[model samples]
Target: MKVGIADTTFARYDMASDAIDELKKRVSVDIARYTVPGIKDLPVASKKLIEEEDVDIVMAFGMPGPEDIDKRCADQASNGIINAQLMTNTHIVEVFVHEDEAEEKNLPEVAEGRARSHARNVIKLIKSPKKLIKDAGKGKREGYPDLGSIRR
Candidate 1:
């Protein structure tokens, strides 16, 4: 199967590369890559990758700037991604890293860890759907820390 990697140029770093490298160790799939200006561009890029490149799946990576507006843009992009997935009948695994994930305690590592983790999930989705079946309704909180019961 072919996989697509769509990342943003606005990112402080290229976490998508880390994910691709991690995926290479387990699967031998063709890769289609596209770099956009920011998170907002990911949805279109992902759709093109699926529709044009004909990829089986897509991995989306982006780092929102340290601002509330950036987070809002990310949220809008996420909604678009879902629409794109439904429209294309494909899966686009999103891996986003916020600039303020952790004050100054090495956010790059956090981004890398999350990107890689989601990459593994992509592999699992193709290789073992049963494993992810139980995760239904968990929402897309993969990279972020589990806050657990935000509102009781």
Candidate 2:
């Protein structure tokens, strides 16, 4: 599978790219990386990359709000593209929220695990069936959901 990864944060992008590279080595996968100026540029950058490369999947990594991410995904969809956003907490306040919850629950380990689990879930969601179809079409496979008649 060919995957395209983009992010606004250089450090996050570097980390995600390294993780993706390790994932590709474990499994059979190809990844392409793109760095964007900011969240506002994501959709445009993604669109350009999609047009230029043959990718089976396009995953965007950033700490943007859910609404912003949704808007970006909608924009990509309008252009017949599939996009997934991976949210990260880069703000100290966000980390404080987690820490507070950990203190309240008296399960710091559990809280940490939850954060890791959520990140994994995001990646899993990006690999869903609908996304697979969209990415496949963007990659080597052309058009999806054929309308031809079934002949038995």
Candidate 3:
């Protein structure tokens, strides 16, 4: 899989790059990294990267509030972009701690745990094959046998 990781904030970008590298080591996937100039640049950057790289998946990492971040993700999706946002309550906590403290206290592990949780959430958001089968059965009762209306 070809994955693209994008972020407007420097810290998030760095963390995302590190996460992508870690993930690549675990899986046979190609990763491309991008840093947006600002929050406003996310949509454009995401669109361009997706088009240029023909990316199979995109992971957008940012520290924005939920509403704004959601809007950005929606915009990317509307542009035919498959993307995931890395959001967490602990974003602030991770940003505040020093690297030494983060390592000494196993913050990287904590961050990895958070990343894995986020990845799982993203997978759920994308709807798995099992979910499609379940929905298909419900759709049959609703007079739609295919249940292929759900768009990625």
Please name the candidate that would achieve the greatest lDDT relative to the true structure: 1
Predicted candidate 2 versus true structure: per-residue lDDT over 3-66, tens digit per residue: 5655554222233444464456445667677777554455545555455665544555433323
Native-structure RMSD, model 2: 13.2
Task: Name the better of 1 and 2 by lDDT.
Answer: 1
- For all the candidates, what are their Cα RMSDs to the real structure? 2.9, 13.2, 12.5
What's the number of clashes in each of the models? 0, 0, 0
Query: What residue runs in model 3 are displaced by over 4 Å at the alpha carbon?
Result: 10-13, 65-112, 120-152
TM-score of 1: 0.87
Error of 3 at 36 (Å): 1.3
Best-matching candidate per TM-score: 1
Q: Taking the tens digit of each residue's C-alpha lDDT, what string does model 1 give over 1-152? A: 68899999999878889988988987987889999998999999999999999998999998898889998999999999999999998999988888887765788778888988888889888778799777665554555664443334
TM-score of each: 0.87, 0.42, 0.47
After best superposition, candidate 3 residue 92: deviation in angstroms?
A: 22
Report the error of model 2 at residue 102, Å. 10
User: lDDT, candidate 2, residue 73?
Assistant: 42
Which residue pairs clash within candidate 2? Answer: none
